[model samples]
Target chain A: MKTVDARGFSCPEPVLRTRNALKTLPAGEELEVLVETVTSRENVRRFALTQKCEVSFDETEDGFRLIIRKP
Target chain B: MSDRFTRFFASRWGIVLTGAVIGLLASLLQKAGNPPNMGICVACFERDIAGALGLHRAAVVQYIRPEIIAFVLGSTLAALFFREFKPRAGSAPIVRFILGVFAMIGALAFLGCPWRALLRLAGGDLNAIVGLAGLVIGITIGVWFLKQGYTLGRSYPVPASVGWIMPVLMVGLLLLLLFQPQFSEGGAIFFSESGPGSLHAAVWISLGAGLIIGFLAQRTRFCTMGSIRDVILMGDTHLISGVGALVVIAFIVNLIFGQVHFGFAAQPVAHSNHLWNFLGMVLAGLAFALAGGCPGRQLFLSGEGDGDSAVFVLGMITGAAFSHNFSLAGSPDKLVDGALVVGGISTYGQAAVILGILVCLVLGFTLRERFE
Candidate 1:
C-alpha cells in the first residue's frame, strides 16, 4: 500500500493532494490517505469514490486513515 | 522556536483568538459610529465603495470605505512579506464575475453577509437564524454539485506584474480618498452627508483597522463561507471553530459594551422577513461556494494578484450598483431613521436572488467534469 500523509494540510489542499496521488494508482493497487480533520478524510474518500475507486476508512488515535483502491 | 505569543498566534489557537479579536473590534467599531451592526461587512463596504466611485448614484450609501482599501493594501504588504504574492487568473473569468454579481444581489436581499449576519445574531437579533439556515442550505447544494463532479477549472500562473494591478488601483483609491475631490463643489467624487453612508469610523482609524485585519486574515486564511463549506462538504470544523469563537466572543463583548439588544423586531439594519433572508443568503451562499471563496477571501486573493478574484470583486461592485439602481436591494420602512431607506427586502430584491440562485445552479450543473 502506498501512503500519502496529509495530516497538517487544510481542506481543498488535502483534497487536492489526494487527487494528485490518485492519478498514479494502477488498477487493483491501493492508496491510503492520512488526514487529521473529518472534513479532509471524507473529502479524500469522496474524491476517490467518485473516481470509481473503492474506499474505506479507520478512525485512528490521531485522526483518520482512508484506504482507497482503484478499480 | 519563537516567542510565546508568536507561537500561539501562529497555531490554531491564534486563528480563534484572531476571530475573537475581530468580533470585539467590530462591536467597538459599531459603537464608534459604523452603522449599527455593519462594522465589517465586505459586501456592504464594497457597495459603498462602488457608490463612492460614482459607479452608482445611490445617495445614501456612497463613501470610499478606508477599511476596504486598507484590506487590499494590507493584504498586499503581508503577501509581499511572506513571498506569497503570485498573480494568477483565467479561471473562467466571466463566470466568476457573474457569480460575484449574484452574490451581491443575494447579500443585498438579506441585508448582510455572513459576518453581519453573525453580528446581528450576537446583538440578539433572531432574524439571522433564517439567513444562517439559508447559507447552510446553499453551501449544502454546492456540496451536492461538488459530489456530482462540478469544477470551475484550475488557475494558472501569470506574469507577476499582472497581480500588481489590483494593489496599485487600491493605492490610487487611497490617494483619491486623502485628496477627496469635492462632490459638494461638483467635485468628481460622491460623499454621503447622511444615512449609513455618512456614518463611518475616522478615516485613519478605519484604515489602520482594515490593514491589521487584512494582514491577519490573509495570514490565517480565515473565511466564513469556507468554514461552512468545509463542514457541509467534508465535516471539517477547523475553520468553523474560529467562527464559533468569533460569535461567542462578540456576544460576550456586545454584552459588556451594552450592544446586545436581541429580538426579531428592528435589529440594526435588519428586516423582519425570515423567508427572504433565508432564500437570499441561499443565493449568496451558493454563489460564494461556487466561486471558491467569500467576498473577503476574494479581496485577499485579489491582493495576492489573483485577477480572477479581482474581476469577481469588480463584478460585485457593479452588482451593487445595479441592485440600488433597480431597487433590487432591501430598505427600512418608510418612517425609519433616514427614511430614505434600508432593512426590508424589496420585491425586485426577492426576484433577483431567485434568479441568481437559478442561474448559479445552471452554471454549476452544466459544467461537466471528467470523472475518469
Candidate 2:
C-alpha cells in the first residue's frame, strides 16, 4: 500500500493526481489519496468506481482520505 | 464578508474580466444583429433553437444560434485542459428538469431572465424594474429556504460518457446547420423568415464570443443570482460590484452609441405588461435559486462538465419549446395565453419556492455542521 497525498489541490487536480498514482501501481495494490474540497471528494469517489477499483472514504480533520484498491 | 468576496474576485480577475468581456461582446452581438430587447439572451436563443427544431410553430423566433455551440465547445476545452471535466448525473435530475421548465416559463412571462431583465432595465425599459424587483423577492425567498435547510440531495457518480452527451448533441446540431441538404425543403426544421428569429450576428462571431465568455465565466464563477444572493445573505458585494460595473458600462455604451431609447411605449420586442413581468421573474428567480445557478451559470457549468447543469440547460430548451408550442410565451401581439396559465404557473412556482424554503429551514435547524 502506498499513499499519494493531494490535499491542497483544487477541483480535478486531486482526481487527476489520484488517477496518475493509480496508473503506476500494479494490480491488487492499494493506493491512498487525500483530497480537500467537497466536489473533489465526490469526483475521486466517482473516479475510483469508474476505474473498477474498490474505494472506502473517511473524513479527516483537514480533508478526506480515499483508499483505493485496484483490481 | 465583503473583503472575502473582494479577495475572491481579485484573485480570480480572469473570470470577472472574461464575464465583462462576454457581456460587452454579447452587447456587440445585439448591435450587429439581434432583437431589440435581446442582445445575448440564453432563454431567447434557446427559444429560437426550439422553434428551429420544429418544437414550436413560432415563425418569428426561429434561428440556429452558433454562440450556443461555442459556449459548450469552449467550456469543453477549458474543462479538459484544467482536468475539471467529470460527467456525472442522477441527482434529482427530474426536479432539476422541472425547475428548468418553470424557470423558462417564468422568464418568458417576464420577457427575460435575470440578465436580460437587467439589460432591459439598463436600456431604459422601465418595465424591467418590476421584473428586477420580483427577481430579488424570489431570490430572497430562496435564501430564506437556504437559511432553513433545503437541500437538492446529492448527485452520485455516473460514467464520463454522460457528460459528453450534451457536447455531442451540440456537435450534431452544428453539423445539421452546416450540412443542410438543399433538396429537403420544409421537412421539419424551422428557420425564421422574418422578425427576431431572422436577426443574428454572424455565426462565427456569435460562437467566438460564446467561447470566450464561457472560458472566462468558468474561471471566475460569475453568476447574476449568486451576486444578489451573496449581498442579501452575507453582505458580500464582490460579484454585485462586477454586475454594477456591467450595467454602468453597458448604459454608457448604449448612450454613447445612440442606442438609448427612453420611454416604454414600444421597446423593441418587449411588451408593456407590468404585473406579469414582476411575477414572471419571481418564478425565474426562485427556480434559479433552487437549481443553484442562473441560465448563464448553468451554461458555464455545463461547459465545465457538470452533467446536472447540462440537464438543466436542456430543460430550459425544452421549456422554451413548450412555452412557444403551448402559446405560453409572451408575444408583442398578445399577453401570452391570457392570465390563466400565467397565474397558474406563477402560483405553482411560488409554492415550490416556499416548499424549498421550508425544507431548507428544517434541514438548517436539524443538520449540525460537522465542522462547527
Candidate 3:
C-alpha cells in the first residue's frame, strides 16, 4: 500500500493528485489519501470512482483517510 | 503542535465561526466607511481597482482598495504558515480565464457577486431573492455538467516562484497605493473624489479584515460556489452551514446598525429590473461552477500559488475594464416621484450575457473525459 498526503490542498487539487498517484499504481494495489476537509474527502472519493477505482474513506479526528483500490 | 488548532478550524463549528466573524467584520466595515451592503464585494472591489489603475475611465469608482491587496497577501501568509503553499498550474488556463471574464460581466450586470448577493439579502434587499434564485439555477446546471464527468483537466506542480506572482503583484499595488504617484499630472493611477470609490473603511481596518478573512478562508477552504455545489451534488451541508451562519450573523448586525431596508426598489448600488438581475447571476453562477470557484475563492487560490486561478483573476480585471468601456455594466435606478424605476443593463450587456451563457454551455459540454 502507498499513501498520498493531500491533507492541506483545497478541493479538486486533492482529487487531481489522487488520480495522478493512481496512474502508475498498478492493478490490485491500494493507495491511501489523507485529506483535511469533508469536501475534499467526498470529492476525492467521487473522482476516484470515476477512474474505476474502488473507494472507501474513514473520518479522522482532523479530516479523512481514503483507501482506493485500483482495479 | 498547531495540529489541534488546525483541527478545530477545519471542524463544522470552526467554519461556522469563520463565517460569523466575516459577517460581523463586513458589517463593521460598512459602518466604518465601505459602501452600504458592500463592505466586502469581490467583483465591485476588483472593478474599482481596475478603474484606479486606469483600466477603465469610470471616474466615480476609481480607487486601489487595500482589502483586495490584503486578501492575497493574507492568504499567502496563511498558506505559508500551514505549509500548504504548493505552486501549480496547467489546468486549461485559457478556459479558466474565459470563465473569469464571463463571470465578471455577469456580476457587473447585476452590480454584485455571490457574497454581495448574500449580504444584500441579509440587509433586507428583496431584489437579492431574484438574484439568488438565478445563482441556484446556474449552480444546478453546472451540477448536471459535473454529473456528466466534466473536468478542466489536471494541474501539475510548478516552480515556487509561479505562486509568488499574485502576492508580489499585490505588494506592488500596496506600494502604488501608499505612494500615490503619477507619471504625469492627472494620468495613469486615478482616484474617485466621490461616489462608492471614495467611500471605504480606514486602510488599516480594511487590511485587517481582509487578512483575517484570507487566513480563515484559506484554512477552511471556504467557498460560496462550493457550498451550493456540494449540497446539490452530494447532500452535503458542511459548507452551507458556514454560509448560513454568514447570512444570519450579518442580518443581526445589520439590524443593530440600522442598515436593514426591505424593498425591491430604491436599493443602493442595485437595480430593480428582475429579469436582468436573474439572468446576470445565472451567468455568474454558471461561470463560477464551471471554473471551480467564485471570485473571492479565485483570489485566495492565486495567493496560494494556483496559476490557473491567477489567470482567472486577471480575466476578471480585464472584463471589468471591458464592461465599463462598452457600457455593459448596469447603473442604479433613478428615484422619481418617490418611486424607484428599474435600472437595467445596456443592450450590449444583454447580448454579452447571452453570448457568455452559450460559451459556458459549450465549455461544459466539450471539457469532459469519456468514461468507458
Candidate 4:
C-alpha cells in the first residue's frame, strides 16, 4: 500500500494529486489518502470510486483515511 | 506539494489567506478610485466594457475597463503555461447566449454580481442579505436540475485558430484604449466623463490586478457559481471557505478604512428595494447555474479557448445593452416607490427574469439523458 497525505490541502489540488498518484499505481494494489476536511475525504473517495477502485474509510481524530484498492 | 512554497500556496489556509489578500486589495482599489464596494465585479466590469465598445449608450456605467481585457489575456497566458488551452465549442451556443442575457438582466436589476453581492454585504449593506439568500435559493433550484441529470450537452473540438478569436478581440479593445480618439456620436469607443463609468484605478494598476486575478483564478479554477454548486452537488466546502474568507476579510478591511457604515438604504450602486434584490439575484443565480458558470468563469473559460463560453460572454455584453436600453436595470439613489420596481425586478426586469427562469427550467427538463 502506498500512502498519499492530502491533509491540510484544499480540494481539487488534493484530487489532482490523487489522480497523478493513481496513474502510476500498480494494479491490484492498495492506496491510502489522508484528508482532514470532510469535503476532501468525500471528494477523494468519490474520485477513487470513479477510477474503479474499491473504497473504504476510517474516521480518525484529525481527519479521514480513505483506503482505495486499485482495480 | 514537495516544494515548500507550493505546499504553502496550495494548502487550505493558503487559499483562505489568498482570498483575504484579494479582499484587502479589493478594498484598497475601491479607496484608490474604483467604485465603492465594487473592486472587481465581472458582470459590471463587462457591462462597462460593453459601454466602452458603444454596444450600449448607458453613460453612467460606460468605461473601457482594462481589467476586463486583462482577465482573458492573463488566463490565456496561464493556460498556455500549463498546456491546458484546448479550444472547443458547440454546446448549445444559443442557449448559453440567452442564459448570459438573463444573467446580466438579473445582475443589473440587483446592480451587482455574486462577487459584488459578497462585497456589498461585507461593506455593511444589509440588503445584500436578500441577494445572497436569493443566490443560494437559485443554486438550490439548479441542484434539483442536476439531480435530474440535466446537462448542457457535450462540446466538440474545433481548430485551434477558433480559440484565438476572443483573445484577439480583447487585444483589439486594448489597442483602442491605447489610442483614445475623441469621443464622437458613433466612434470606435465611448469614455465616461463621470459617474461609475469614470471611477477607475490607474490603467496599469487595474490591468496588473486583473492579470494576477485571472492567472490565479485559472490555476485554482476559482468560481463563485461553482463553489455554491459544489456544496450542493457534492457537499464540498473547499471553495466555499475561500468565499467566506473573502466576505469576512472585506468586512474587516472596510471597517479599518471607515467604509463600514451599516444601513440598508444608500448603499453604493445598490438600491433599497429588498424584494427586487432578492428576485434579481434569484434570476441571476439560476441563470448562472443553468449556464454552468458565473460571468467570471465564463471569461476564464473564454481565455482557455472555450468558444461556448466566449459566446456567453458576448451574450452578456448584448444583455447589458438591453438592460439599460429597456429600463430593466435598477438604480441607486432613485427611489421610485409603489411598484415602480415590478415584482422586485424594477419594472421590465421582472418580466425578463421570469421568462429567463422559465426557459431555464424547461431546458433543464428537456436536456436530461434517458436512463433506459
Tens digits of lDDT, candidate 1, B1-372: 233533454456767976887787788777777888787889999899889888888888999898889888888987777656767777788988999999999998888888888888888888888889999999888878866767676566679888999999999889888998775665458878988889998988888888887887776667889889878776666577888888988888889888888677667777777788899899999998888788888898789778888999989998999899899987753435655332577778878888999999999899656543
- CAPRI grade, predicted model 1: incorrect
Error of 4 at B242 (Å): 1.2
Q: Summarize candidate 2's per-residue lDDT along B248-326 as a digit string, tens digits.
A: 6667766766677776555666766666667677778877877777888888777765778888898899988877766
Where's the lowest-lDDT run of ten residues in candidate 3 chain B?
A: B363-372
Q: Which regions of candidate 4 fall more than 4 Å away from where they truly are?
A: A1-71, B1-11, B182-188, B334-345
Residue B211's lDDT in candidate 1? 88
List the candidate numbers ranked by lDDT, top first: 3, 1, 4, 2
Model 4 chain B, poorest ten-residue lDDT window?
A: B338-347
Q: Please name the candidate that would achieve the greatest DockQ relative to the true structure.
A: 3
DockQ: which is higher, 2 or 4?
4
How many angstroms is residue B357 displaced in model 2 relative to the true structure, after the best TM-score fit? Answer: 12
Off by over 4 Å in 1: A1-71, B1-10, B183-187, B333-343
Q: Interface RMSD, candidate 3?
A: 6.5
Compute the lDDT of residue B305 as modeled in candidate 1: 75
Model 2 misplaced stretches (Cα beyond 4 Å): A1-71, B1-12, B181-184, B333-372
TM for candidate 2 is: 0.75
Query: Which one wins by DockQ: 1 or 4?
Result: 1
lDDT of each: 0.80, 0.70, 0.87, 0.79
B1-372: candidate 4 lDDT, tens digit per residue: 324543454456756765676677678778878999898788899899888878888888888888889889988987787665877787789988988998998888888999889888888888888998999888888777766656676566679999999989999888888887666756747888888989999888888888887776666566788789878866766667778888998888889899887888767788878878888888889888878787887888899888988999999989999998888888784445633332234557778877877887887788774321
After aligning candidate 2 to the native by TM-score, how far in Å is the CA of B27 from where it should be? Answer: 1.8
Local accuracy of candidate 1 as per-residue lDDT tens digits, A38-65: 4456557656766788999997765689
